[model samples]
Target: MADAEMVRRETSFWRHAVVTVPAILLLGLASGWVSNSGYGNPWFDGLAKPQAMPPGWTFGAVWTTLYILLGVALAFILQAPNSGTRRTALILFGSQMMLNFLWSPVFFGMHQPRLALAIIVVMLVLSIATTFWVARIRKAAAWLMVPYMVWLSFASILNYEIIRLNPAS
Candidate 1:
């Protein structure tokens, strides 16, 4: 009977994990689309990018994967039993998500690469802290945030380069 209960609990935990991926992906897509709609298409093509700038397709692919991971991490945190650590984790997670959502608008829609770079730096720091907090509850949750942190690091560099190359943009 005890073994059966353990199995049931594990199954419940996994069910939440399975649902998180799609929910996060959808949120990512919605935010991306909303920001994309406000920006002028010609602006992107006309910008003077640094030589190191990635192919246009890469941005979408990388963000999609990171967003999925973010979703899973969040789901794990949500599943944790109520505790002070869980509350802090939720706050950190939500803060980073808000920052992530704002990035597209600042960079593409407003055409402020410098500001975007600054925002990304903050986002990176917050994400790292959030990862640490989540690790306290679930190590896998913390590990899941690694791709996002790495991607933001690269993005910050790219944003700085763009600001340097396109001073007038």
Candidate 2:
């Protein structure tokens, strides 16, 4: 087996958990802040929602779960041996995260679902690219990102539907 794979396999659960858990916690906190800041205002409440739109509470639950998964995936990348692939993966990861954070502000705070849709589309692409890069370095890390990718796709459809539902916005 490769040295990196061996290192990963040999890692103690407690040691790894100590690192990944805190990192995940921080991610969850930041994402929660972003969500709280831009969600549940009168403006958003006034907007026409798509037929398939989930309940308001669902967003919070789903995002929290996804952020935790993202933290674990990032831990894998960070723990991996430094290499060009790792660097590239990190960049993609960072880019997608920023876009993810920005979407709420653009859509809910700014009240521009159209622009938000555009942002999410880009986010989806970046997320996919990140997944591919992460897969190259660590398949398990890549698997961690699957839910995120799926969520982004679902989010894109929701955004598109929002646009169609509210043409004036």
Candidate 3:
């Protein structure tokens, strides 16, 4: 009987994980697509990008992977029961995600690298705070965000450099 109960609990846990993970990933995908729309080709090619700018393909690959990690982190957070801290963490996560979605459009579509850099700086700060809050709920979830933070750090540098190179942009 104990073994059966354990199995049931594990199954339920996995079911929740499945639902939450995909939902978060879908959010990321939708955001990315919305931000990238009407911003390809000449608009992107026209920019005076930094030498360290990754190729277009790299952006797709990296974001896909990062989104997966983010989804997993959010899933871990959702596994926990409701609380004030959880609410705050979720809010922070949503805010940073919104900021993340805004970046591509501002930098690529609108050709406003300086503004994008500022947005990214805000994103970095919010992400750090979110990660810290998530850590208080689930250490694993917080750890999962570390790679994302690292990526954002690199991205901020890239954004700054783009602004420097494309002052007219």
Better of 1 and 3 by lDDT: 1
TM-score of 2: 0.84
Query: Scored by CA lDDT, what does every candidate get?
Result: 0.83, 0.81, 0.81
TM-score-best of 1 and 3: 1
Candidate 2's C-alpha runs over 4 A off are: 1-39
Against the hidden true structure, what lDDT does model 1 obtain?
0.83
Summarize candidate 2's per-residue lDDT along 1-169 as a digit string, tens digits.
Answer: 6998766655743366568667766765675465554345777777777788888778778877887788778877877778999999999999998888788778876778899999999999999999999999889889989998998999899889878887897
Screening candidate 3 with a backbone cut-off below 3 angstroms (N, C-alpha, C), the clashing residue pairs are none
Model 1 stretches with alpha carbons more than 4 Å out: 1-5, 37-40
TM-scores for the candidates: 0.89, 0.84, 0.86
Residue 101 of model 3 has an lDDT of 77
Write down the TM-score for model 1: 0.89
Root-mean-square deviation (CA) per prediction: 2.3, 3.1, 2.6
Clashes of 2: 0
Cα error of candidate 3 at position 21, Å: 3.0
